[model samples]
Target: MLPKIQHLLKASPAVTALIGAGTDPITDPVRVYRHGDAPQGVVRPYVTWSVPAGDVENTFDGADADFFRVHVDCWSDGDVEVEQLAKAVRAALEVEAYCAGYYADERNLETKRYRIGFAFDFILSRE
Candidate 1:
């Protein structure tokens, strides 16, 4: 991973380093708390992602290194709900450019609530 990606992941309050841990291509989504302070009759969905390494490019002027990409998938109980949450998270992360995209909903055969899922990808690089 690029230094910036590593730095960000290492700095996450929800993450910890596991010594001698094997590196795998991570594409799994994790669930997290939406907010620390709860509101009256409101619940939020928040998720954090691990940084995954991508390709690297070397150049004479400077090495344009694309270290990795990080994605946080969020879900909410209504449409555009996940999108809004994702936007907030992106803003907090200071990633200026991203694509807000939607995907299929995952649910069990039993009880289900109105669920929405959206994702935004981040590309980290240094030249």
Candidate 2:
């Protein structure tokens, strides 16, 4: 599931522009991680995902549906950069699926980093 979502995001032309620019360390592809880990150093926005929510099976169809939450974290040395990345994330993902909720965590004083994030609640209909 994570791989599919990652591929989908990376494949989009708009998201691709942000990830493929290679203008700076932060301008590379958004690192999509299924584990709870992130790149260490000053870099661009990356993603880490948690174990998703429960699965709700649909007997009528070959797919199993679930209201899963994908937590996206945007990291950057500057706040605005991360915020923009987060917005890109929303634009990239929300347009593709049914987004039930959204949120943002801009910064943490202790970390001195920008972490604009969102909880994407979407259903996965698999065959």
Candidate 3:
């Protein structure tokens, strides 16, 4: 699920324009990582995400789908940049997932960086 989300964000023109398409997508500026995995000194305006909750849906017949509640955070050096990055992230994910909505928009006092966080719900077919 995280890989799928990363692929969507990496492929989005809007997102790439803001972040970047590094020579190597895996190590590039768009810099999408699972929460707490981004390396120190990463480029600005990057993205980090996590699945805080999830469930397996089963019917009388069998399990059919898996549901995940994902949190995506955008970090940037400026307020406006963070907002734009968040919008791009939302746009990329909303194509294949439902956006529960934004949950946080604040500046980290210690780092002086803006962070915007949002939630998304994804239902993936087991089959």
Global Cα lDDT for candidate 3: 0.85
Model 2: how far is 60 from its true place, Å? 4.7
User: Model 3, 15-118: lDDT tens per residue?
Assistant: 98887875576665558888635688888888889988998888877758889999999999999899899988999999989999888899998989899999
RMSD of each: 11.0, 3.7, 2.0
Residue-level lDDT tens digits of model 2 in 98-122: 5555555757678777776666766
The Cα local distance difference test for each model comes to: 0.40, 0.62, 0.85
| Candidate 1 local lDDT, 1-127, one digit each (tens) | 3224233333343321211111442332223323222234333343434333356667788856563444444445544554555445444444433544544355424424233344445554573
In model 3, the Cα lDDT at residue 5 comes to: 80
When summed lDDT is taken over every stretch of 10 residues in candidate 2, the lowest stretch is 18-27
TM-score per candidate, chains pooled: 0.42, 0.71, 0.89
- Name the candidate that leads on TM-score: 3
- The TM-score obtained by model 3 is 0.89
Off by over 4 Å in 2: 1-3, 21-30, 60-63
State the weakest 10-residue window (summed lDDT) of model 1.
Answer: 13-22
**Best by lDDT, which number?**
3
